[model samples]
Target: MNSAVTTLWEEAGFPEQTVIQRAVSDPLLAGQSVVGIAPTGSGKTLAYGIPVLTRLVPNLGPQLLIIVPAQELAIQIRDVLTPLAHRLNLGVLGLIGSANRQRQIDRLKGKPAVIVATLGRLADLIDERKLRLVDIKTVIVDEFDSFETEDITTIRHMRQDGLLAGANLGLFSATRNDDDIAAFREFWPDLQVFDEIKTDDTRGPVTHYLLDRQFEGKVQFLERLGREKHQRVFVFFNHKHIMQKVAGSLRFTHVPYSLLATDGRQVQRAEALGDFRRGRTNLLLTTDVAARGLDVADVTAVVNFELPNNITTYIHRTGRTGRMGESGTVYNMGNDHDLRDLRHLLGDSVTLVAEKPLVKKREQDDETNDENTPSTDSHDRARTRPASDKMPARKPTAAKSHNKRKQRWRNKKNVGKHW
Candidate 1:
């Protein structure tokens, strides 16, 4: 073991002979393939990063190619590894959709020791021949289970070309299933198996509040939560049209909320997220689009205006709130249909309480200013779909009003004479 890495791990308070460390240290793993299962925040990044980095030195090529499911997770891993790689004077690059490709291409030419990126963009670069992975010693698919099912074919082709059917392949995820591993093994049936999470219980983040209510009552529940706690809230919807309708209703009700639909421009998505992160906006009305890998640190709650299609989505949606060491709530608001769906998935033991309608309207001036704010796209993708999921091809329509009936929620503790 590298003394520096061992020291760093000890400083991190990580246990010795952890699953991650063992996987990284095994002699056979250098150029082998395996499925890695580990709990969230369980030092998985370092586990793979260390071995990959060691291969890069004295070797000439992009030794490691890490494919993450989300841009934020790519950024998070990049942040986590770049520093550690630097400790050994190694080069690391982040290739993400939101960032410039020209720069990434320019850096790729330098033969970076490691490249961390999302699958779509990274695969695009590989297809374009901008980054050759022929000499990649390690190929880490961070969230193999989350990769878009449609892209699995493409991934197989790339694996053949990039890995030359021989590079070491490592797949890691917090939640893993035997079926997923079996499917992955079909890609390389000879691959070794490491089928276990270090922790026995891989609990998810956030406090789940499964609320049984009318479809219309969700807004009232959210309005109350917003007033009771002046913190950021991410509201999710399974359908984009439903999310748009929800945004329109919030506008009509003068609710303090912003819609982040996926159909908007990249800059708009970035700005909406920035506004939320910077505390310029307290309540955000979005769909699962914002659920994956977003670092909206102080998000006090995740309001599921609609239930997710599956248990995995439920885990990811709630994971957004209870991030790092901070605790938060996940409120799943639903109708009778939603309740039935939940019963089929989570059993009937979960209890839900009826919360009072909470509303503290914005001041007259704030309302006027909100009207001046630009209107949100009814086709907003952020409020509707997760990045990994695709939307159906459809025609567009006319634009809607931006400053739709927004009520400013200034603190009641500081209500001025203007109010």
Candidate 2:
């Protein structure tokens, strides 16, 4: 066992490594730049942590750097790594976009053994000379696909500053988005690729449940599931307002729920997550920002009050469940469009029942759908297409010219022969 891993983790319900983990510490990645693609909850952290903590010196001037996507995740990672670091006697410094600015700055001065943070804040500190990556031998970019889009500029600057030379890079994400992976070649050309989840796991792929309703029924259904009190539950919504709204609605039903919004001060978010872990709350309602990199126990279900906007967000949302070899169900609800997105993510995981979709109560839809749907003229009615009509459009075929038709006849006698 690695020295940094704590004994306390045994009681914390550490699932046996999936087939992926068994093969991950393969000979290739011992100290090499690498990218990993594994199913959600397959213990990607430990896969990298074993190498990082085993290599970096403890209680030094920030020898390790782990970049994540959100502040909630920073605290969560801190919670998991701190105890391990403690076992190794390492001080972990977090440079997230959350509470305690001066305090975080102060912590940076001490130069904790590890610095886990968001990219933007980390770059700002580097420019300020508040932190140095010169000693950073091991660097990890978690949820790497996330950094491909909106975060391209900042990440590029960080790499340019000195990531290529001394740092051993690790990029991890549930989404293998080929474009994003292709972009990483510029940064680390020698990245070794390994996917262990393909054949090892006996458990089947993820299971998706799409509720046919305008999202309201799904909330009621989730409340009922909470009544069963199966175990820890993560509920995701697309918008912060919708998250709060669902939280409020769940509260009205008097189900014990914890709300984690992106708008609150980073401390409140941290506290909310801590409370959820401590069993103070069973139902955790959150936005996509907190969807990834959160390790919680006994999460039996993930409820999507409002289906995610894209396949990537859907993956992150459902990933909160069915992690670490424990299977969980995902409840997705919303308009037909939402169901469509769910199908894309579900692929072959969920079974689509031919049962009738929850009918739109005209009066209720007039209340909710009216806000989202643009107003149209009463004289011209809307033409409703079947939910199956979302395929890409095909190009129109052109009529063959007379000369081209004659040439085709000439080619018919000379099949497989080119001029």
Candidate 3:
């Protein structure tokens, strides 16, 4: 590590390195092309930020180019690294979609050491000749899995056009599957992959629960849970309409809440996120747009009003809580179909909880009846029915018997295989 950069890093109060930082810091600083996979809030920004900052030379025109999927994430990365860059007498510019293009061009005149930009804005600026990548030494792509093919193509074109010639590339994200890795490797054949992600076991101290309920029932359940728990909460939905409906339901129930979604105005989104972060509102209703990059501490619970389509979305949604070893809980509300999908994705990692009181009462009554009845008599009664009973029984077929025997033998053979 560079001595000046080390002093600035320590001064920034990050004395201890996270697992990702420790793993990739050396390789990244050594100018190696690395692809890092780690959980959200694992200090990935700093892990790559340190390498970029350490290698930066002042007044050298943009030496680092950081591309993100969303403008919000671009601003976030700029906010995190700007102070550190300023400490070293370096400039950092954020080029996002919702900002003034001419103003950004004016800032580019100074030639900041680092430029954080969204994929679309960066491409536009590069095409207009407003931004040049000739001096770039490193190109960091954050949240690479969420990027579209066109975005990836832009990066490939940069390299092909010699704009980013000899620049080391680093891709970082919390979600990277086999297909994502394979797709990335097709573009950069020599990219080194490093994965430290343990989504199942390393989610800090989060407890996951599946609630059996439909859409309306989930809204009621969420209202009840919100009234009962006095902690910060985030309720996620898959669509903007669903998020709006949930927000209306919360408002009707007199629950203090705020909305954050992609459809909302930028100012409203900023104010809503700020209000939730500052504890002005305890509940935040949002969609997957707020799933990956938004980081808010003190969130003790996450509620999935609608279950995500895949395990990766589920991981990022629940990752809003239980951050940095603090204990948190995630409640997933779903019906039978949703439950089946959740089970297939999470396996036995999630606990099922009955959402309605009637269901719980009925289950308790069944348990009581089982305890009070005689086992032998109950079995005989179940097998033999009276003439008054309308239902009829038929004898089992030879094929059924043979299949039962085969299943029994297979079970016996694989008694402890799964355990």
Candidate 4:
């Protein structure tokens, strides 16, 4: 590592290199196309950032290009590396969407040594001839799985177009299944794989609680949790509508909270994130837009108002809480179906909290009680006679004798009249 980069790392107060950081630093610095897999908040940015910075040649027109899934992530990586890049007298720029295009074009004239960009905006700038990747020597794809097919195609196209013909590619993510591994293999035939994803050890130990509750109950519980816990909390919802609904509920309960989603304005998103980071707000309600690549510190707990539909998303959601060897809790509010899916996905990692069972369980219990209790017909039969034996015949009253005598006299008179 360069002395300047080492000084920056020490100045940042990091005790030592993390497992992933230590494992990949040498290989990345050696210009190998590497794929690093580790849990979230495992110092991935620094792992690649330091190596890229150490090899940066100032005034060499963007030798490093780092692409992330979202604009927030791009800005985050830029913010983390900008100081270190400056220490080495290297220019760094973060290009994202929803910003002034002309301003980005203006910054491009300065020829940054490192460019962190979101996929869409970067592609747009490249198409418009405002940015060029011809000089890029290292192409690092952070959160590689989050990139869509089109984004991957664009990057592949760039490489095929000879823009990054000789550049080293670094792909990093927290969660990668067999399919992801296969795709990586296809992308880079000889890609060096550095995986440190120990299910038990990665991201420390996160205590997961499966709260079986509906939407309304989940909202009520969140209000109570916010009032009682009073710690940094991230309430995650799978949908924007649910996040908005939760935000409204929190507001109705007078809980100090901020809303974050993909559709939010750039300024609003930044303000919400900033407020939460600065301790201005204790709770942040967000969708999956903030699920991956978000590095908020001291997130004491994460509440999943709506459980993610997939295992990968669930991993990322829970990952937000227990980070960097810090102990944290994940409260998941889901129905029976969601719980079943979670159980299938996470196995025993999630502790089933018999907290408020869903309506299904209550219905089942009611059915069981009904089976134990006697019905109306059964009660009547039991009161009347034993149901096991035959039913007794009915007996006539004394009025039958008088009616029989009167009917005989009337029949004799009618027979004589007819003759």
Most TM-score-accurate candidate: 4
Ten-residue stretch with the least lDDT total in model 4: 351-360
- Per-residue alpha-carbon lDDT of candidate 1 for residues 303-367, written as tens digits (9 for 90 to 100): 87888787767655665565445677777777767766776776543344443223335555566
Which stretches of candidate 4 lie above 4 Å from their native place? Answer: 178-187, 199-202, 349-352, 355-419
Model 3 Cα lDDT, one tens digit per residue, 1-419: 67865786696678877777777888878888888888877788888997678788889899999988876678788988998898877899999877889999999999799999988788899999988899898889998888777767778888888998878888988877666656656656778888887532335677777788877888887777666645788888888878877877777667778787765666887788788888877888887766457777778889888888887788778877887878888888887888778888876645555444323577788888899976666547866867577365689999999999999998787654410
Steric clash pairs (candidate 4): none
Cα error, residue 203 of model 2, in Å, equals 5.2
Off by over 4 Å in 3: 199-203, 228-230, 348-419
TM-score of each: 0.70, 0.75, 0.80, 0.81
C-alpha lDDT of residue 315 in model 4: 74
Q: Please give the lDDT score for candidate 2.
A: 0.69
Candidate 3's TM-score: 0.80
What local lDDT does model 2 show for residue 205?
39
lDDT of 2 by residue, 201-224 (tens): 533334566677765777777677
| Model 3 local distance difference test score | 0.80
Candidate 3: residue 63 Cα off by (Å): 1.3
Cα lDDT listed for each candidate: 0.66, 0.69, 0.80, 0.80
